[model samples]
Target: MNTRILIILALIIAGIAGWFFQQQGKISPPVNIEASEVDYEATDIKAVQTNEQGETEYELNAESLTHNPVTNQDEMSGITMNWEPSDEQRYRIEAGSAAINQQTGELHLSGGFTLVSEDKVSENKTAATDIEPIQVTGQTLKGNTKSRQVYSNEPVKVVQGMNRFEASSMKANLETGEYEFGKVAVTFTPVERQNKALF
Candidate 1:
């Protein structure tokens, strides 16, 4: 299936998370990480990732984060993430809990996962327009930072403008922009036609 937008959405999450993993060491002073021991702990964490042009690409906020040295995993609670690939669009994601593996570059999100995509207009020399935002909801999301692959076995729903799609499961390759869905259902609303009184 064609899922360019979703691919971009997942990639935004993966790319930013990967960057955060690489920089986690800088977030705090060096701590002796022993097997089965806590590496570090932090609260009220807020981080931002910027591109080469010095433009903010992603922002993350969380209530608490803990890292385990033995497992090489970072677990977080009350997570909120914002991703902006360009001036035209922004995506916001929220979850109650998440876990990222520093060694494997795997991220697992659970506890009420929601992703919202919105259209953004630049303030400088740009035309303003209104468009209904898109939203994706699922129980869990798993992404590989190195491979740029995203998959979920639980039920997933996606809303784009006036259209809706639901599936028993979903998988996507961000690198190739490929999407696969299982037991999919789709609903498309002809807003323009309704406005023209063609229905």
Candidate 2:
């Protein structure tokens, strides 16, 4: 009887030890992830232009512009854009530190940039038509002396007439007076439309 009891106790202990080992095998160790770093640089840039209008044209300056040949990416530092004032809404012009694609001749402006419009209209004694802040990244841009078009894989905001629109992408044909946006979101303020009859 003593021998049989000892044998049973040994079997029970062995079973408990096996169960603990199985549970330990089921557990997985934590994984470690490492962070990555990116490196880049920029330098002094300047641009000047003369407009036919009598209004004084402004100059643009920047600290630096850079392009990564390995990634085909470009960047600009401390960019500035300026324009000449004119009574006639003649043309759309942009000047800034930009990265030009060697293959396609596409230009990309980066860092601090400003866009100014010559067209200004007064409505209800308020200066209503004004250029809004814009940030553009694109594959190419094509336009003429009178109009401009910017094509990109990102969104663009445009205000025309009394409506403002945002879209994922766009093709603006300024010559034909046509602009189309893909997956567009538009908003119109009621206050602007109220004065439409007066004009």
Best by lDDT: 1
Query: Which candidate ranks first by TM-score, i.e. highest?
Result: 1
* Ten residues in sequence with the least summed lDDT for candidate 1: 188-197
List candidate 1 stretches off by more than 4 Å.
1-36, 51-55, 85-89, 102-105, 122-125, 128-131, 145-149, 172-180, 186-199
Quote each prediction's TM-score. Answer: 0.61, 0.38
Give the C-alpha miss distance for residue 118 in model 1, angstroms. 1.9
Task: Give per-residue CA lDDT, model 1, range 1-199, as digits (tens).
Answer: 5699889999999999999889884746567864657879999999776766988877889999999877788899999978675566576879889887856768788997986765567777465566566577899989865565668899999776767899999886644444688999886565464345556
| C-alpha lDDT of residue 8 in model 2 | 97
Off by over 4 Å in 2: 1-44, 49-60, 66-75, 82-97, 101-104, 110-116, 120-148, 160-162, 173-178, 188-199
Candidate 2 lDDT, tens digit per residue, 97-184?
4554444534455332223344445343456445543333333333222233445456656555445667787664433334567898
Q: Candidate 1: lDDT of 43? A: 100
TM-score: model 2 vs. ground truth: 0.38
